[model samples]
Target: MVTAIVLAAGNSLRMGTQNKLLLPFAGTTVIAAVVEQIVKAGLQELIVVTGNEPDLVHQALIHLPVKLVHNAGYGTGMTGSIQTGIQSAKGNGYMICLGDMVLITAQQYESLNTTFEKAYHRDKTCICLPRFNGVKGNPVIFSSAYKNAILQHDDPEGCKAIIQANNPHIVWVEMDDDAVLRDMDYPEDYAALINL
Candidate 1:
C-alpha cells in the first residue's frame, strides 16, 4: 500500500489573498487536479494536509476519496504538514506531493510509483525521486524507514535535508516531462499555467 500525501497547508503569501490550491485549473481546482493524478496513479491511500483556509481546501476536495489532516503548525513550514500526513500513512512507503503542482499528470505519478516499487524490492531503504534533466522534482517517494527521521526533522528546509543527507539511498528516476518541476507560487505562475 503506497500512500500519497498532498501538502496543502501553506498560506500562499505570494498569491496575495487567494488560496492557490483552491484556484481553478484545467477545469478543476488546483488541489483537485493534483489529487486526481494521485488517484489515477493507483496509489492505495490518499491523505491531504490542509492549513491556512482548511475549510475552503476541504470544500475543493470534499468529493474525492481522501483523508483530511489539519496542521495547526502550518505557519511553521512544509515539514509540519508532512509530519501531520505521515502520522496516518499506512504504506511501507509514501509519496510527498505538492498541492500547487497541478500540472503533474497521472502518468508521471505512475512512473514514480513504478520506479519506487523496483527500488523497494531491491532495497527497502531506497528513496525514489523524479528528476528532469538532472533537476529533482515533486512527489518524491520515501520508504517508511525514514518516517521517524522525517518526524524528528526540525530544520525549516523540510525533507530536502533528509534526501541530501542520504544521497546514497536515492534512486533518481529520470523523466521526459517537465510538469514535475512546475508549481504555482504566485499569481503569475498560476496565470502561466492557465495559459499553457
Candidate 2:
C-alpha cells in the first residue's frame, strides 16, 4: 500500500487573506482538486494535514475518503505538516503532495507511482520525483526507509535536504507535462490557474 500525504496546512501568507487551498479551481476547491487527482490515480489511502484553517479544510474534504491530521506546529513550516502526515501513514511507501498544486493530474500521480513500484520491485531504497522539462515537481514518493529520516528532519528547507542527502537514491521520472511544475501560491498564480 502507498499513502498519499497531502500537505494543506500552510497559512497562505502569500495569498494575503485568502486560503489558497479553499479557493475554487476547476469547479472545486484547490485542495479537493489535488486530492481528487490522488484518488483518480487509484490511491486509496490519503492523509491530509491541516493547520491554518482546519475546520474549513476539513469541510472541504468532508465527503472524501481521507484522514485529516491537524498539525499544531504548522506555523513553523512545512516540515511539521510532513511529520504529522507521516505519523499517520500506514503504507510501504508514501507520496508527499501539496494541496495548492492544482494543476497536477491523476496520470502524473500514476506515473510517479509506477516509477516507485519499479524501484520497489528491485528492492531499492529510492525516492521517486517527477521532473517537468528540467525542473523537479511535486508529489515525491519515497520508500518507508526514509520515514524516520523525514520525521527527524528539522531544516527550514523542508524535505529537500533529505533528497539532497540521498541524491544517489533518487529516481527522477521525466514528465512531458508542465502542470507538474505549477502551484497556486500568489494571487497571480490563482489567476493563471483560472485562465488555464
Candidate 3:
C-alpha cells in the first residue's frame, strides 16, 4: 500500500491575510480540490497534516475518506508538519505532496505512480520525483529503506536535506504537467494557477 501524505498545515504568513487553502478555485476550496484529486487518483489511504485552521481543514475534509492529524508545532515551519504527516503514513511507501499544489490530474498522478513503480520493481530503494520542464516537482515517492533516515531528521524542512544528500538514489521522471510545480504561496499564486 502507498499512502499519500498531504501537508496542509502552516499559518500561511506569506499569503498576506487570506486562508489560501479555503479559497475557492473551480467551485471548491483549493485544499478540497487537491484531496479529491488524490481520491480520484485511487489513493484511498490519505493522511492530511493540518494546523492553523484545524477545524476548518477538518470540516473541509469531512466528506473525504481522509484521516486528519494535527501538527502541534506547525508554527515552527513546514518540516514539523511534514514529520507529523510522515509519522501518520500507514503504508510502507509514501507519496508525500503539498496541499497548496492544485491542478494535478489523475493522469499526472498515474505518471508519478508509474515512475516509482518502475524504480521499485528494480529492487532498489529509490525515490521517484517529478521533473517538470527540467525542474523538480512535488509528490516524491520514497521507498521504505529511508524510513530510519527520515525519522532522524530534526530539521524543520524534513526530507530536503536527505533528498539532497541522496540524490543518487532518486529517479527523476519527466512530466508535462506544470501543476506539479505550482504551489499557492500567495494570492498571486491563485491567479497564476488560474491563468495557466
Instruction: Return the top candidate by lDDT.
Output: 1
Local distance difference test scores for all models? 0.90, 0.89, 0.83
Q: lDDT of model 3 at residue 49?
A: 93
The order of the candidates by lDDT, greatest first, is 1, 2, 3
Per-candidate TM-scores read 0.97, 0.97, 0.94
Span of 10 residues, lowest total lDDT, candidate 2: 154-163
How many backbone clashes does every candidate have?
A: 0, 0, 1
| lDDT per residue as tens, model 3, 36-119 | 988888875789999989999899889999999998888887777767777877776788888888888877877787677677
Better of 1 and 3 by lDDT: 1
Candidate 3 local distance difference test against the native? 0.83
For residue 115, model 3's alpha carbon misses the true position, in angstroms, by: 2.3
- Per TM-score, what order, best first? 1, 2, 3
Model 1, range 125-169, lDDT digits (tens) per residue? 899989999888988999999999999999854788899898999
Using TM-score as the measure, which candidate wins? 1
**What's the true lDDT of residue 24 in model 1?**
87
